[model samples]
Target: MMTTVVWLRRDLRLIDNPALYHAARRGPVIPLYILDEQEDMGGASCWWLHHSLRALQGQFQSFDCPLILRRGDALSILQELIRDSGADALYWNRLYEPRTIQRDREVKTTLQAEGLEVKTFNSSLLNEPWEVQTGQGGPYKVFTPYWRQAGGQITAKQTLPVRDLGSQDRETASDDLRDWALLPAKPDWSGGLAWRWTPGEKGALDRFDRFLEQRLQLYADKRDFPAVGAISGLSPHLHFGEISVRDIWNRLGHFEDVAGVETSVAKFRSELGWREFSSHLLYHFPEIPEKPFRSQFSVFPWQEDEALLTRWQQGRTGYPFVDAGMRELWQTGFMHNRVRMVVASFLTKNLLIPWQKGAEWFRDTLVDADLASNSASWQWVAGCGADAAPYFRIFNPVTQGQKFDPQGKYIRKWVPELRDLDGDEIHTPWKVAKERTGNYPDPVVDLSVSRERALAAYKSIK
Candidate 1:
């Protein structure tokens, strides 16, 4: 019987995993996970990865298959595994990140030359990044047109998890999970993350099921409110590929016939489409992660103030809404989407800081820190990306807080310093008595002055 080694990366789960499914059918399957330095993650992401691997390791135990853990160069590791395990075939899912794409290509070529059967499949995206193209057969730069084309091609196509894995009892040498040190040690700042998240395949499925049953109908109307529990909260799971997008897409169809759910379902699906669009943008424009998509903005004036950036990151920007979002991210490793926009806008425009700085901070702090989404979103807010928001469209943090978080429930929960303030004052505690506001600092920058500065900077480039 043929022996196939299944290399796992972002696709951590077994359900609807194409590479694992196909490899299981052929013969005995060996599951492998390698921690290549090229794909390093932040503190929060590492914490989640540790638990995710532990959960997956337990699942594979049922089939008596050890999830081989190794760290170092992926090519050398794979070659060593092939030679040692006597495995004749290798199977894995595709990752679209620029560095991973190059690494996978090298691994595939070298293994194929050595006469080992190497195969890869897409297990994350509903559509491959290149599959959806414009009328001229080029990549899409705008989202609405892109989704209009891409959304049409999606179907309720589903793949099942491997149900029949032939036993492989060989005790191959494997690195201990503790050696990876993916979890924090000295400081151990992941207490809040533990309270907020359950990072595994079962957790992802449970969250989705809850959304479908109770919150799907309210998603469109209530998703903007930071305090509301209307979101699917599947982003971190999706980033780690704990659940398949195809499965989520197919499951949403089950509620299509339910009355008054059309708008909510469509809204929720489009958010997924945005996730696809981010991948599409990154694949086509690999330089976007490091540079501006709109070349004219390359020379745009941006201040380099470490103190200001630190204030923003610490949620001490003095704008209650922006501070609330930042604090929430620090505490939970996630932020509400609407508040993300407002905070991003404030950093890029109001604070005159570079968007790249904001992106880097988010990458380090967010559990769902995806390169594509982080890069694309920062650029969009900075007015330097494909189909970006206009430069003059500055988001007033005070008004944004008042509008989205009307009762200040979201703000109070995250920014407790101002929790005692009255209804209207919660969004702008600087307006109330200084003693009552406690240590909540005053506005870091005069919004009026900074707005003009940002506009002048844009004018210089234009």
Candidate 2:
């Protein structure tokens, strides 16, 4: 009997998985997952990884396939598996992160050299990052034109169905999931993550179905509201390839009103486009994870305030909205998209801190923390990325809170100190009488003065 190895990476799901489908077609497939610590697994990322792998294991068992786990460099582990299993072919879906891309390239070269048939499929995004480019043959720096071109190329009719695999499970050596310890041990801080997501293909499909049934119509208007379940909270699922972008695009075809459907679909699709844009930027400019994409940002002075950063991370920044968003992230491993932008701006602009600091924090904390999204978004807020928000457009935390969380319900939920304050008082608790019994902290910085300072620093770079 022919033998094949299906090496799982970011795409952990069984349904609609291209690699697993193709592997089963060729021969009896051995499912494999590698836990490589040398590769950077940020704090919150580790938490998600642990749960995601566990979920994948459950799915594999249902299919009667044993998921073999190994810890080391992927190339070494794969070679060892190949030698032991005597697999004729190896297959996996593509990954877009810089380090992942590099690692895959090296692995493919080495494997092919050893005469093993190696194959990869684009299962992460609707379109490959390199496939879309500007008319000038360069990658797009701005979102609008890139999104337009991407939308024009993608059609609902083109989506591939989830290939079915016959009962062709192969025997393999597997490891205990707990031995990997992808989660924290001593502190066991992942209790928050358990409340946030189901972390598998089943969860992704459920979210998609619910969004189409209930929330897709009002996505454009209600997405900005943190308190409402207006937006599709599928970033982590998308990041892990639990669901495909094509799956989402095809499902949105039911809405008939052209204007409303187009508006909502266009907005939702653009977010997926943003994911592509981030990968494209990272691909063309791999240095962005460490340095600014724009050269001038190197000269832009950034403050070094570990104390303030700690306050921000701990959700003690004294700004209700900022503290609320940070606390939301801490407790749930997720934050609203608008608040993500606001908190990013507060870190880079208000605190005069470097975007790298904020990016690293998000990387360490966010369940959906993606290299492309986290790095690009932070740089965008810092005005140092491609087509970034103007640096002078520093977010006024007070105005932002009053605008988005107008009722202050979101603030009160996360910032318990201000829980007793009424809607009008919760947003600006400093203005409330001290005797009112709300134990809210004062403003961390003078907003008006800090805004001016941020503008001046931005002007110096310009």
Q: Pick the candidate with the highest lDDT.
A: 1
TM value for model 1: 0.99
Distance from true position, residue 25, model 1, in Å? 0.6
Predicted candidate 1 versus true structure: per-residue lDDT over 395-430, tens digit per residue:
999999898888899999998888888779898787
Instruction: Tell how far residue 308 is off in model 2, in angstroms.
Output: 0.8
User: Which regions in candidate 1 have their CA more than 4 angstroms from the true location?
Assistant: none
Q: 1-462, model 2: which lDDT tens digit per residue?
A: 677788888888876678888888876778888886767767778888887888888877776666778878899889988988888899999887777888999999999999999999987777788888899988899988988887687755455444434344335576788887778878888888887788888888999889887888889888998988789999999888788777777777656456665678778878888988888888888889999989999999899999989888988887999999999998888999999999989988889989899988888888888898888888898999998998888888888999999999899889877877888888777788887635566777888888899988888888
How does each model score on TM-score? Answer: 0.99, 0.96
Model 2 lDDT, residue 380, Cα: 92
Candidate 2 at residue 290, lDDT? 92
lDDT for each candidate structure: 0.92, 0.84
